[model samples]
Target: MYAATRIKNRQRVCRTLVAALLMSAGAGAASAQDQPTISMAINQSPWLDSFVAMVDQYEEETGNRVELDVTPFGGLLEKIRNSVRASQGSYDIVNVNSLWLSEIYSGGFLAPLGEIEANYQLPEGVLSYGNTTNWDASAATFSSDGALMGVPVNGNVQVLYYNTEIYEQFGLKPPKTWDDLFANAKAIQEGGEYYGFVPRAARDSIVYNFTPYLFSHDAAFFRITGPDQAEVTLNSPEGLKALETYVKIATEAGPPGPGNIAQGELIQLMATGKGAQAIAVIAAWGQLEDPNASRVVGKINAALLPAGPDGMIASSAGHWVAGIPKNVAPEKQKAALAFLDWFAQKERQVDYVRAGGVPVRGDITGADLGDEAAFRFIEAYSQNARHAVMGLPFASAAEASDAMALSFNRAVIGELTQVQALNQAAADLAGVLERAGFTVSKLPDL
Candidate 1:
């Protein structure tokens, strides 16, 4: 409720500011066309406050009206689908999650940055994930030879989050390895005060949560065996080992009934002090510090995710990028580009972090924001993002992710053994890849 109220207040303030700017600029309806009103279709996120602040500043300074069509996370794709597929949709700018990049790319819904602006180039030192901005349309895959579809706006990573007080109580420092984390989690769980860890097992969360495990272990959904080959490896020995460990972590060390926790539920559990640790998204750090929303206000802290036995530290990179829809007017596209350019400035990115957004720029995240930067997540996120990788980057990424979610959920809930789950997932992935025009027959039957 507080968040809702805050957003409402911000909207009111933004409208007032925009009205004042229009008045000062003598912007009658006749002059309004001079300042384009580009609209964005975005998912409501933990960094909404930051996003609104950024937009507010953009509108006031440029005299351009920007309307945000915010939707719930689950509804984001549907909203984008409705807008892009229409003869003339309402959204000029479409927020692209890396996981959905291929879907949007394959459908030809978004205009490449180069297409929108002939001279477009990624800003120096700006991190782009999974070839998100680059797309080979003919092959429906991310490639350096492809067009620039968008610019990354958020650099969200999975970082290790723990209760400082709990660690201090148990003489534990933040874990640097999976073994260390497992031991600490077991100790905390046995103490009977809190669940050692909370997991995100909700259907939407499983694929991302599981991918880091696979990556850290040097296992993958499939390795590129040839120029266009996707060999099923999720049921390989290494993959099996990773899945087994993940299941043990979730079922043996996590809370009772750990199979259904979603992103919000996991955050709430940690905030309420019911959970001692987790590998959670950097964006979620905001709510954990909100006095009214969290009981563990200052108790929680973040660290880089633990390394696997081989010492590889992999983290999930599911960033959000902004792409201009091809369906929008040319003026709107230019306006959208203007906003993207404004947001990408280094100074503006720092301001965004202050307003509660996790910026994609490395320089800003690595900078010292000072001791005055209280109750914020910066260092840990900075460390984690350095090792982050796009969990699943494929033309059929959505379907592939859904398969992982289903199998992981089954394993978590004890409905399927870890081995069976991996077997099913590997077979499902092969079919998904083959149907999407990739070679998938290399693997021996799992």
Candidate 2:
């Protein structure tokens, strides 16, 4: 009975989504000569080729043209900001990072998907695979006040990648906790063939690499105390401990010039066997199996990140989503939504995964991928995404992240002690919130 009920429910969702799609098509149907060209801004990454292929398929099937402007992940947000400020319909569809969604939505630059289709509902599986609480609180990321805003294209989470040969050589088991990770890193470093671990520590990348440690140790930038009151909380003992652990790893066991490392470099370091382990985005794992890019193709293995003192595996969700800008013509808006609807279908999503993109739908993650190691890693990542948090969801998230990055990079370079760094970060964050019109109380001393 339970199985039957589930099947019926899934069929119902499919029917509803299909109905919405048909409605969208009918609403926008016009003379063939009146169709407008659509363009999209996408991030250049491992998945770019796959997305391009999908877009080609879209064009072939719909007789519509889409120009793709591929930009580096670091620059995409700034590009969107500039375009929105000018009210230029530079692109009909825009790729958005989860952390940047609140800013874009609050800026009034997005056309609420709800307004486009009032009865449209996300597939049950998509919601099941995301951080449900966050999806509710910051609905703008996926939907705003029950209106869909974007379709998630990539589901990202941090995982630990280790060199199996190195672990066995040193008699080390996969780390179950942060202490184990540190000890293993130190041992691997002392053993001399490779650095113990390599993690992204560049100014822009440090916050992402540090979040797991911070959350595992029960530290956060702010804690809501009342209906509208909050306090900075990153100067507590847990915060200091997490920062100290990060600094020790970077200075003692990481590669020379730790501050210069970013995700691409870190991946190469691991793939070239220069590093024994890396804690990075799971999406990069696909590259590790590429013969053209990796030397240690079969030598690498992945696992859920080590837990913290609280015995919880804390990961950050860095999923990428696609939204339509409000500046586009109404016809272009409809075309963009039509494209998004087709791209997010289950069959296309599966094709995307097979072609090197990360799948954000639960059914896709749970599907049998035939490769045991690949399936195991993706399964772990999917589980992590459900509980992960994208910290600092306010419009000032970028500013807050920058402040934390400065403090973290300072600690990495030995300019400040862990306590000093975190305290300074807390103060910086408080100032950011205050300027944004939120009342923040002073954090208690550790």
Q: What is the C-alpha RMSD of each candidate to the true structure, in Å?
A: 5.0, 8.7
lDDT of 2 by residue, 331-421 (tens): 8887777777767766656556665667777666544455545455666666666657666766688899998898889889888778778
**Highest lDDT: which candidate?**
1
> What is candidate 2's TM-score against the reference?
0.82
For model 1, the superposed segments whose C-alpha errors exceed 4 Å read 1-35, 87-89, 224-229, 365-368, 373-375
Least accurate 10 contiguous residues by lDDT in model 1: 15-24
Question: Which residue pairs show backbone clashes in model 2?
Answer: 139-143
In candidate 1, position 255 carries an lDDT of 85
Please give the lDDT score at residue 307 for candidate 2: 83
For every model shown, what is its TM-score relative to the native structure? 0.87, 0.82
lDDT per model vs. reference? 0.77, 0.73
User: Residue-wise lDDT of candidate 1 within 148-202, one digit each (tens)?
Assistant: 8888888888988999999899889888777788899999999999899898887
**Backbone clashes per model, in order?**
0, 1
